[model samples]
Target: MTIQENRERPERSGGEQSAAEPSPPDAGGSPAIAVEGLRKQFGSGPEAVTAVEDVSFSVERGSVVGLLGPNGAGKTTTIKSILGMVLSDEGSVRIHGIDVYDEPRRAYAHVDAMLEGARNDYWRLTVRENLRYFSTIGGVDPDSIADRHERLLDKLDLADAADQPVRSLSRGMKQKVSLASVLASEADVVFLDEPTLGLDVESSLTLRRELRRIVAERNLTVVVSSHDMDVIEDICDRVVIMNEGRVIADDSVENLLHGFDARGYRVTSADLDETVVADLRDRFEVTEIERSGDRTRVEVATDSDGFYALTAFLRSRDVTLDAVETVDWDLEDVFVELTRREER
Candidate 1:
């Protein structure tokens, strides 16, 4: 069949089911996306490399989740396996209760994706035309979603250039146009990879705010992959971080930031000198030390127990504590700490 025919074809039925088809989904209560024991490898024998191994996670309905990793962390492979673009060597992926590998069309009926900051949009088509075209191919009547297209164009700052050809727009404009196309489809589940790439600071902020609003308004279940930690922290309800083909952390952003023992403490004492600083270095990981007049301040990384021990040591040395404060950590720090631990 031609590509056009395949795009327009209805779901295959009855005897068309494959021999490896998974069982039907549960009638009640299932996650929007569920991946279990997913594993994928390349090559063979001693030369083989495992890109992903025993990775599993789930996305609940109407939640925005961030899929994060450093380079070569198997993020792309996991996403492809979930989208049915790459067949996994093991495990299963389910979308809204239906197994993706068993029934791809049905599983992806309400799904859309913008990969690598772009979609397969027709560059020759006008901005509005691309939106309508994508909506049609995504199994929605173009006329039925006209209002959505208009809102998307307006919200994405593409309304003024709606009639212009996509090829005529700037790279950032084109990126926004691609996102508009995906959002125009009214898909329940969306996967956005680097959705803010190529956008300027103002445009990036606009996209982040607008995306959060749109997701809440439409109850979109979204999986976003981006190297921008700020974007992920601002938009995602939870994050799943991977390193070296394994999931190192999966939790709410708040927990990941404050729950780890990686917290740093800034302690100021009036009696600290070069000798005291050296003693601190011997006892703990001192990140910073500053001497101002008669006071010395030191920053140390440690947990609560270590902090207590530090206080005891300070008292033993008769160092009068002037002030102590906790240093705040952001998502990037947490991500680095988690991934570094995995590497160690």
Candidate 2:
């Protein structure tokens, strides 16, 4: 379900686009986006606010990197600086090896942004009008990109709403239009900030799946920033976690989850004996013990690697093996663990 469908907007088929226009990522060594020592602050004196400090990261071409953080984490500020919407007090931002500060026009030529989503569009204009208008303003001849514009409307399921006034459509529908404009653009890199903010569950999931599909099919480099962890986990190949205007963690989702996993578990068995229980407590960090009708459950703080040791201990006392499983952590859990306050 796309924004149009979510809002019950009409549908219409658009002209087919040529497959030759937008090229895939080049096989070069330079990253699609590079930010080093990015620093930004607002105002001065004792009350000056630091929005981004010491943020640095590089995004590989054809990769989706998620920028995550709690409120005031500098996620938006970092993105704005990269897009040149905000000036950084220090550090450098390079888009496809072109320094934005040195060559704003050339660097921004390869980039397109969908910040603030639907709010970026002109509410009075029809969906098609907005697309063509942006196509003309973004340094591309509207006539030359007509096929591409039509294809975006069709691809994003916005064709039906193409002639509908943006003000009459739902907010989500308008956001779809904004995304369609960026996707149809011939730009090399796209920055999406909270693309799924107002979307429903099914629509959000649908958008996420479509985004992943588009990135794979187009081999486009995308930087997605959102508070939706599920969207990030589902769409991003790597994540750059931030907290309090600084990057707290940067790595692949799998690696972060692995690093934060505690390997805790609970085991229930009916044939337990006091001797074996004592041995189990002595051998492992048993956190809790519970007893029910002819059954006992033991919670152990150990990884799957120690399951064998636990089994051996139980077997030595003639206890039957029941079950063993490794604990798992989702992206949200890892985010909380890394971003939470630390104690001495």
Candidate 3:
């Protein structure tokens, strides 16, 4: 579809809206990363294990895309293939229009990765020493290296620990240092594999914020492989969920949440009878019913119009609902619903 056409479409439930409109190509400005019909299989003959199958997607420039899946779902394999660490049996991966297999050096020129425990600095070196070492290796100009070191140290809140050895740093600090190394390289595309794996709540939040900022300010394309639903929902503009080496869902987080179309209402009343419960169940997915003393609490799922119908049904039966509270859907619910559907 054309860019203008894509921009005018109204949002809709399910994949109908998004799948119908594939993103337009960048034309002269190629996408930061693109994978087409990517397939990977380990070993040969009957003993082979297919790790990735027919995966196709593109990361828009400056966009933060989340790569999500359950354990052993080929996320790592796909990432490794993109980085040219592993060769795909079929399909192609391009970084800034340079085919990874055809020209590994050129394709990797725009790419930088920080897989879990990625060693970008020496443990025995001081933080300042590590920065200087990476800067020189990355070929930063002498004047610019000094400027970048000061900026990175201050921005990542590592100035206080600048003189400490890398081994003495906390997990969060190390993560920050790793991220700083990537930023220091001035690469256009970055892959962060479980960036917040061992971080505490506050550290995770900080890392996520920094990632978003870097992507926005630098116009950097980033692929974050993470299991944290909250992190994906908060930072990602879109997500690609894979299962058993195949992509099951590829859409914006908003679209995923809306696709489920499951909304709930909590109703409190003096008492409820079996007949009333049966009547409500006929029209809605009754998730829960709790009773305590004189009050009865019922949780029912219904769409906007269905909710109105439910209220009318209750009124007709002379059941006075003391309070009705609406509950909005969230990413966790959407994730569970989609993953469950895929399983079946």
Candidate 4:
């Protein structure tokens, strides 16, 4: 389907039948963030560039929703507009039913965000000091600050580095600190942009695990923007994919996979001939056919019944089939196919 077509469909109600039913509010569980017909433009007159166009989606309270797209697809612009960093020319943004533009303070009162490359500390301050300072500014009680600090430091695996200065920490370490500050606030909703960018594999895994734990334990709403499909698939319950300033797809991971409905099979045989290849192609979409010396490899797209038919055909022809197995497609494959269809 086209990008416009996909956006026109109703957002999934997270297995709910009615929009009015009492449920957990936002993406996670509560209704934390609701956006409708949001639009933003960068310049005026002939130089104007449209950043986002008619984007609409709701994030439940306490769920992790992923914003995914290629570069220049307006993911960042949508995020900034919601955070009041960039103003939207048209449309509405609501945080827990409070309109952001109408009541910025009240709307963002329970929200905390970690923007991409956001610097959150004084260079000379120690890690513990930075958390303490943020807590003070955030109006966290003095009595609870120490307890919160120790919990975050330990949870983020930053306890050992708590005494070190912010400027002396590695990039991953800095990111962990920034995340700690956000969590320490115990904000109802959290926006994280590229949280695992530039981290090594181990650090990325660690961060993902911590994020999962935080969301599950605290029931906090989370809206995350990232190009990392694995992160999205792993951490987010649903994903909203955008391209050219418009939402292309918004569905659970399973539904998105179901949409493709393409199944593949790999077949290996000996002494395969042109007639056999032609016959298989007539029955199924041939994805690949490779012949190395005497052994041949054949890959085809077919559902269960078609697969059975192909096997029966080969047996009827007395073809020596060595092996057969189903081929599984990942989220990346579905993403490319859907996006390419939209582009066309």
Candidate 5:
């Protein structure tokens, strides 16, 4: 099915019976989502293209996980397989201990997703009307959740525009509305893709802060996929990184950033001439160099031993160190390092 059809699925039609209360995942503790050895391929024989291979991960209840990878790294395929949008070639996916393929309705009764930014929203419907409509389709009574919708609008800063047609709103506002619609439903598990795709700095920050608040308030389980490293680092408790259709790193943001041993440094010196700069480049991995008037700054990635040797060489050349700063590694740095290592 197309993405639009998938987004609108589990829909109730006229004359259909009211949906039963969503069954709990399992009696004992079960993960909100679990995928094991998932693999997917397209085409046949020599033309076959494997989009995902042996990707595995689990997300606990009431937590947020980020699914990350460059293009063609299987992030999309893996997500689709878990959501039952694509049938995988191997492995298993369970939501709350209920097999997705075996008991799709029970497994996904309390799940909702917002894919491709603002596309999930209805352009002609007012913001409030869209929320009520989605809630109804999700087997929820819109009137019963009216207070919840009000709170969502206030928290997302859409209260003023609650009655405005969605198409009349700005792009960033529409994105916020799409997210609100997903939360408007009674779904406990949510998937958000590129939640902040086209927002200004302030708008992005607002959405990020409100999303975290709403997730915590509801104890919701979230799986987010985005190209924004800062968004992942700020919002996710853990990250699952994919490279070449395989799982390369799965750990908390803190562990991944700290576990990486490579450290970078920036040094500024007024005495760094062309000779010194060339010599420094030859001896170390100098990633960047900048010269402003009489001051020159150099950035290098190295270990403790290499760092000491660099200082010694600079001293020998009579280069006075005007300033030195350690460059702390962020999520982007760790991601690049891991993906590059896999490629090598």
Candidate 6:
């Protein structure tokens, strides 16, 4: 099929990527989503609240980038500005290299958003109906996306509830429906805000796995915003961390962990004596220590060389190391540490 032909054209449902349009055609290899010097204030005069400030970042094509920050950190505001849902007083926002500020229709055509608050779906409509409705509004012909719709419904485990009213569904089911609706839009880039919020442990894990599957299979780029660091770490290729309305740290998740986790170590062995434990406390920052039966486990924060010194110290005290391993930082640790430094 010609690349120029709309994948949404329903007559040709035989392709692998019909569940969604192929990733947006490259615009001279430009960034998929781009924002620069974005500034937004909520009100006029001295009482105004600055929601975003000097924020800038770019997401390359076919990459899932996490947009993270603490509460009131301007994450939401920055996202809204980029989507053109809220106007910014300054800066440029682009989607697929098309300026969202100046051409919303053209830019948004390549985008899909699965947001919270039930605002993105019709409560009264059945799951399948809502998918079709969203696709229609998104400029997709229903016939064109029928197969893709079925594929998404099956992938999201919504096939059984395809005809059930969203209003009657559980919160988790409704959230899944919202995701299906976005995927049915056949857009290359999707913005998901708090996709795993309020889910049970199993549901969260299921959703995360399904999301990764969809993004990978469809070759889509996703910008996910969520407080669930597990979801971010599991699915995101890179992260753009925010603080006080500014881009604080932007890097790959591996690099972030490597930088912060370099100081972490875990030592496990049997019969750690009081003297050695005391020396450990005095020499390094110990976060965890447990002793049960003959086994003792100590987790500490120290530099790369600090572990060598730690092992030497233990040996000096007749403590034989059974197992020593590097402890990696979870995304939460990296998030907190980076934002903390920004605050300080």
Q: In terms of lDDT, which candidate is strongest?
A: 5
**Please, what is the whole-model Cα lDDT of each candidate in the order they appear?**
0.82, 0.76, 0.75, 0.76, 0.84, 0.79
* Candidate 1 Cα errors over 4 Å, as ranges: 1-27, 117-119, 267-298, 308-323
Worst 10 residues of 2 by lDDT: 10-19
lDDT of 5 by residue, 267-332 (tens): 999998899989988999999999999899999988777889889999999999999988778999
Candidate 2 has what TM-score?
A: 0.76
Q: Which regions of candidate 5 deviate over 4 angstroms?
A: 1-18, 273-275, 289-296
Q: Tell me, by TM-score, which candidate is best.
A: 5
Count clashing pairs, candidate 2.
Answer: 3
Residue 188 miss distance in model 3 (angstroms): 1.2
| CA displacement after TM-score superposition, residue 15 of candidate 1 (Å) | 25
The better-scoring model by TM-score among 1 and 6 is 6
Q: How does residue 77 of candidate 6 score in lDDT?
A: 84
Candidate scoring better on TM-score of 1 and 2: 1
Model 6 agreement with the true structure over 215-235: per-residue lDDT tens digits? 788778899999999899999
* Runs with alpha carbons beyond 4 Å of true place in candidate 6: 1-26
Candidate 2 Cα outliers beyond 4 Å, as residue runs = 1-28, 141-151, 266-322, 341-344
Per-residue accuracy of model 1 over 1-344 as CA lDDT, tens digit each: 00121422211111122324333344377898999999999989999999999999999888999999998999988987787767899999988888877778667767777778223467788999988877766656789879888988888899999999988999999899888887887577888888888998888898888888888998889999999999999999999999988888999998888786648799998888888889999999999988898899999988778889989988988899999998778999888988888888
For residues 1-344, what per-residue lDDT tens digits would candidate 3 score against the true structure?
00011322311101111212222234478888889999999999999999999999999899989998888789989988887667789999977787767866555644667776455456677887766655454344435657766777787788899899878998888777776666665566788888777777887787777777778888888899887889989999999988889888889988887775547788999857878888888877999999888888899887777888888888888998889998777766776666778899
User: Can you write out model 4's per-residue Cα lDDT over 224-338, one digit (the tens) per residue?
Assistant: 8987888888898898998889999999888887775447888899946889889888877899999998888999888777888888888987888888887866677777776
TM-score of 4: 0.79
TM-score of each: 0.81, 0.76, 0.79, 0.79, 0.89, 0.86
Better by lDDT, candidate 5 or 4: 5
